[model samples]
Each structure stands twice: as structure tokens, then as C-alpha cells.
Target: MSGTELTVTLSGGSAADARAVVQALEPTFGAADERPGDDGATVHTATFEHEAADRPSDGASADAARLSAPVTVTVQGTPEAVEKASATLSRTFTTRDQGAASGDQEQERELLLEP
Candidate 1:
């Protein structure tokens, strides 16, 4: 992770759906340090670094990826990072902010995403 790091956990959808959501974030957040795996896990996880102000897809459209089903994404990191990730994801998918919780230095936000 080069800058602010955040780990994104996704579930309630096929593995492919999970990967699509993560890839959708690549333009703004940069490619993830840890990419979503092809393993047949019910829950998929990936880590990304926010290369602040280095967004390659400045006006990137959400045409890069699409979901086959609803997926729940949980982003864990500093409050700022979590918020940023949620915002970026929302631009691509129809999402509902399920909820959020914060610890001393870290926060977790869950978003229910629909195609």
C-alpha cells in the first residue's frame, strides 16, 4: 500500500461480482495492492491504497464493470479512507449505506450494492 490503506471485504454475491466491484474502484483508488482472488470463497477481500490526487480515471465512467447480483462491501480503514471508498463505489453502483462503526483509529462501513 503506497498511501492510506483500506481493506475491502465483500460478500452476498458471486466471486465474480465481488471482483467486478473492486475493479470498478481501480480508476479512482488505483489498482489494489491486494487484488481480489479467484478462489471460490463466499467472501472476498482486497486492499487498496489511496494515491490521493493521482486518479487516472478523472472522469471515469462506471462502464468498466457491472454486477450480476447485490453485494455487501465493508471497507475498513481510517475514517477518511472509509468515507472516500464509499463515495467512490457509490458512483458506479446503486448502494445503500447499511451502517458504520468506529474504533479508536479505524472505521468500518458496510454498503449494500445493487446492479
Candidate 2:
């Protein structure tokens, strides 16, 4: 299964909440390359190798769906993976644009997970 490399950045939430998000994403994206920011922010970056015709498993998807905190997430990937990730995450986290006029070149999207 050829997959695109992606990065997911998480910030603006408690450390525990941020960890939970990383835990949720691990099954699908594998172990994250974590970077803890100043204060209580954390970034979990990984690549997801999902089949072209498949969505992420419900179990793995729901891991993030269970969060009820306000955490911001940024995903960078191919258009398809970005869209799929946004939709999957929106099931539990509130999503919005990163306010970039054009995301075509960067292939990045950002979202805020509400508590």
C-alpha cells in the first residue's frame, strides 16, 4: 500500500489531552515523531499508509473522536489524505481552515478540537 507522507501538529491543549490525540492517531499513522512545545503544547507527526479505497478503521478513528477538549491540529498531506483525515477527525473534533488563502502548494490543513 503506497501512502503519502504526512505531518500532524497538535497544540493548545493540556498535555494529557494532547497525548490522547497522539495515542488515537498512532494506530493509523504509526508511532509519532513527537515534539513538545513550550508550555503545554505538543506535536505528533506521522505518516499514514491507508489504502486508496479505504477509510481509516472505526476503532482507530474513534480514538480521536472521544476527545472533548480544545486542541488545535494541523495536517499536511496529499489532498485526498487531508480531506479524509479532516472528515474522520471532524467526527469528534471541531475543524476549521488554517486561514491560508491557498493550501495547494503546502497541502496543509488545520483544525481546532473543541472541548
What's the lDDT for all of these models? 0.79, 0.60
Candidate 1, backbone clash total = 0
lDDT of 2: 0.60
- Candidate 1 lowest-lDDT run of ten: 52-61
lDDT of 2 by residue, 13-108 (tens): 666667666666555455566634345335544455545234353345455555546788887877666665666566545666564223655467
Which candidate gets the maximum TM-score versus the true structure?
1
Q: Write down the lDDT that model 1 would get.
A: 0.79
- Tens-place lDDT digits, model 1, residues 40-85: 7888888886764456444334664478888999999987778767
lDDT of 1 at 114: 90
Clashes of each: 0, 1
